[model samples]
Target: MPKTKTERVTISLCPPVDLGGEPGWIPFDAPSLVGESLRFVSGEPDGNRFRARYYRDAEQHLHARIWFGPETEGPPGHAHGGAVAAVMDEALGLAAWAAGYPIVVGNLNVSFRNMLPLQKVVTVESRVISAEGRKVMVHGRIFSGETVYAEAECLCITIPGK
Candidate 1:
C-alpha cells in the first residue's frame, strides 16, 4: 500500500476562527505557520546566569523566566532599570506570538516602580490584551522574587512575513 498525498492533521481553534473552520492546518510536507514548533527549535539563550527561558501556557499566554547576574548589575549589587525593561520587552514579544500575532515593537513604554536585585532569579510574564489587523497591544511585568520591579505597555505591529 502507498500513502496518498492527502494527510491527516490537527489544528488549534482560536477565539474566532478565521481560516475556515480550522485554526491551524498541518500539511503532510510543510508547516503553514511558525508556532510552538518554531519556539522549541529556537530555544532561548543558555549557559549564562542572566538567561531568559520562554514558555507557553495552556491558555496560550507567553511566559519567561530570567536571572540577572553580576555582569548585568548596577548601583553595586542591584539590577538596573534598563535591564528590567529589556526582560519585559522579551516577554511582550513572546506574548504577541502566542496570541497568534507575530509582531515587532512599534513603541514601548516602560515604567519603573522599584529596585531589582542582581544575582536573583527574576521572572517576567506577558500577554496580548487586544489586537487589530497587524497592530496589537501587549502588557508585561518584571518581578524580582515576587516583588515587581517594573511594568510595561507596548504598541506593536505584526510583520506578516514572519
Candidate 2:
C-alpha cells in the first residue's frame, strides 16, 4: 500500500459584535423559546452555512446579527434570495414569539432591495407592528449600515390556545 498525504482547509469567519456587552441590549437563546425547529437557519452559530445571534433591546425589540456563509451564495459572491427569505421567515416569526405571542408564520412577503454579499455580518431588525385577534403582523429589514438588502412583512397566526 502507498502512503497518501492529507490536506487541511481553514475557513475564516467574521462574527457579529458582542451584543450581550452592549448597553440596552440583552442576548437570548432562540431555541429555548422556539425549540430546535429554528435550527435550520440559526442552527450553526459558527457553521459554514449561516451564523445567527438574537438580542432584545431596551424596548424589547428583537434583533438578529446574522452572517451568511459561502454555502448561502447564489449569484457570484452574493447570497441567494431564498437564503435572505429564510432569515426573514425565522426572524420575523421569532419576533412575534418574543413579543409574547406563540405563533407560526401564515404568510411572508419579502422585497429584495439589494443583493447581499456573503461573509459579512448584517443586522435583521424586527418588531410586531400590529396584532388583531389571531393575526400578528411583523415588519423587519435586513441591512448593513446604509445598505438595505431586503425588507419583509410577516403575518403570523397565534397558535390555538397558546
Cα lDDT tens digits, model 1, 1-162, are 998798968643212211111122221110123444433212323422255555555666665556665556777888776666666665676677667776777988899877777756655768788898888999898775567888899888998887
Task: Give all candidate RMSDs, comma-separated.
Answer: 15.8, 3.2
Cα displacement (angstroms), candidate 2, residue 18, comes to: 6.7
Q: Least accurate stretch of 10 residues (summed lDDT) in model 2?
A: 13-22
**Candidate 2 — which residues are off by over 4 angstroms?**
1-22
Candidate 1 collision pairs: none
Index of the highest-lDDT prediction: 2
Q: List the residue pairs that clash in candidate 2.
A: none
Model 1 misplacement above 4 A: 1-49, 144-146
TM-score of 2: 0.88
Query: Highest TM-score, which number?
Result: 2
Candidate lDDT scores, in order, read: 0.63, 0.91
